[model samples]
Target: MVQKDMKLWPFKAIPTADGDNFKKIVIVVTYKGEEKQFALEEISSMLLIKMKQILETYLGSEVKNVVVTIPAYFNDAQRQATKDAGVIAGLNVMRIINEPTAAAIAYCLDRQCTSNGATKNILVFDLGGGTFDVSLVAIKKGVFEVSGDTHLGGRDFDNRLLSHFIAEFERKHNKDISANRRAVGRLRPALDFSCSITRARFEKMNKELFQDCMLPVQMCLRDAKMEKSEIHDVVLVGGSTRIPKIQQLLQEVRDPHVFSLHNIPPAPQGVPQIDVWFNIDIDGILTVSAELVGTNNKNQITITNHSGRLSK
Candidate 1:
């Protein structure tokens, strides 16, 4: 919400369990000479209301049931807060789902994109604006299980950019622009004429942050009892995944060999070479290469799911 030219936003954090998560952020709005306080839940409710209005306009009817997705790392308080937002929005939220789990379900189950009677391990690297999550999910037998991290995300990258830009500005003008909101607004547009940091420059400036992106992924994989090489496919989800640097960091989730299907186990001795090779392309189709044990014969097949979509 805004009054005059000033916008309302969360101004302070309210601690939740473990002091790592926020229960409810404090939203402060200054109107006249007085300040008003609102819970972050209220802000969420307002957003939800607007979203519902948009959906209703499109469908030309009332839509109530909602399956809201939240970060996999949300604590019980945060999850309940989201539900409260739904109630305030006048919508019946049927379920609160982990964002990564929802992404995996949509990518595989809803689309029926899975292999034929075979289980596949998936690494879901979700890099969002505020929070990053790395989920190791196994989809099989009509079930899915996941392990994830909630503390890391694109906000870290954003901070890196801010620091780099601010340093460049300070070096040129010898002034601190942190408190200068108007100047900050012009930072991106004024880039061409200024010392605008390039992607490579930003990556170099914040190398630690770039590498930190993978810590959760490695932890989740260990928890899931899987090796990175065993993952059949890596699904990229969330807006932060759009960054080239982020994409590079997340490619580890993708069977870097998925395109080549080179996770080969040794063949038995005293026998001709037999190879099991499968390549999973961006289209989610898996193509397997099978070499006959004796001669120079090669066999291959394209695997698809019930919906006629390529198995991820």
Candidate 2:
């Protein structure tokens, strides 16, 4: 038996353009599971340092090429920004893969799907901590090809959930949480985390996170037109997916067919409120920049995507 020592770690960062709020950073290590956290100010830098420290402590290997996953809907600037993040982490940029593509790659690696060369058109629905990406991929033998894809992701679900929380909390506490970013910021993770876990056992672990969060979740689940026991085999990709609420919810919503919970949460109609935000005319509801790492690359950065280049 040949001992395989190859390891690949994929990193992802999800930023909300609406409030310039960055939600989480995730790293999928080959055979080592995942490391994730919600990012704070200068988080990209702090995250890079943390990654280096983790690599030093855990792998005892020098950092080499890394695959950074960005949203498919992200423009050149957004992609560039993602690359810059990699550079900061002291990694030799291998390729800037879409979140869905990276996810499919992760799945392939995890499942050992690419031993030889085989081609198959696989549909990948990736709902991350902050964004959602739906992709159609052509895997030939071993070389994976990403065909069509869209960016309708998890953050949208969070926003929807956040809105629901605000409304519900206001009704209960008689105070608007939305207006208070601090409170919303603090409570958002707990509520968001619980909403993902639909498993019954999960309820026992994180009780407080779901105290006032249940009605909103139930309502959102209803609005999504799904019920418990309907979810199964949903690829729960991001940190948020680990939340028992999501797992539980998917169990209810995608019942019968097991939710993968392996890839990003697929854009089931009940999950992302796409129609409300996506304006076909504008190409996307909001624009993201893919930045290149260079000097003076502070806020006023330049990014290039498939569309073109933009100066920020």
Candidate 3:
């Protein structure tokens, strides 16, 4: 069940390598006093089933159809695996959308557009829990054109931190906890044994990883055939974006234009604030409407076409 001699699945291969040429991955687990073998997708399905139950409970309805968001760099096989996981969980996978694309859509829908109706080229820097994606998106007349993607993210930083502390723990206490999962887990919770880390030191430790984040940004600009100055806005998405160093690096890339779209500024006194609302219907059409708080002034745009070719 280990398939130790078989080649590991190449999930990151662009234009994913043909699955037929590789052996399937399986793992053995003891269940009810018996050994059971399960494929990787089956295990993934089990997790998805639990997630579905939670979602159903929250929504108070039986759910079936789902739209899965994946990393922008995911190839056909990876996307198909995601769909299969959903299917195995007893849900119909409606559509697979790129994570960056989805973030860009939400940004466009909620953003306050200039009255001139000029097209804006925005860079989306999405560094989520496990994967990072950078996309150069051109929003014109409710259409989105995307470019660039990446796979590095917050998990790499966590791994680096863990390694640093483990080494420190070994030096101080003369104990090797690297091979001890329980010890490592305890260390992660509190680092209880008189160890400390400063922001500067933490940033220094992961300096290379921080610098690597810029590569995708540069690639996105080149692939889009646009200069850094052309990026009207730099939108940061995901929890990892809150990192000060990450924000600083983004500012260095797009100096004055770097801003978190998630932060809503307070409206000035007596000023009529525009309330923008976004809604995506069942058919994948996005409708954005804006209304003046104290007046009847309103405008709306509906994006019917969600398909676009990413820059190569």
- Put down candidate 3 lDDT per residue, 124-207, tens digits, no spaces: 888886678788776664324343334467766766777788789899889887766446656665556556788789999999
lDDT of 3: 0.67
> In model 3, which regions exceed 4 Å deviation?
1-21, 26-38, 112-117, 141-151, 189-194, 256-312
Error of 2 at 96 (Å): 2.3
Candidate whose TM-score is highest: 1
RMSD values, in order shown: 9.2, 22.4, 13.4
lDDT of 2 at 277: 18
**lDDT of the candidates, in the order given:** 0.66, 0.45, 0.67
* Worst ten in a row by lDDT for model 3: 5-14
Q: Write the per-residue lDDT of candidate 1 for residues 44-138, one digit (tens) a residue.
A: 99999999999999999999999999987788988999999999999899999888778779878654666576786767777786677777777
Tell me, by lDDT, which candidate is best: 3
User: Model 1 residue 123 lDDT?
Assistant: 71
Which segments of candidate 2 are over 4 A away from where they belong?
Answer: 1-43, 62-65, 110-118, 141-151, 190-236, 239-312
Give one digit per residue, the lDDT tens place, for model 2 in 3-91.
11011002333344335663444332223454554333234556766877787789877777776666666788667666677676677
Worst 10 contiguous positions by lDDT, candidate 1: 1-10
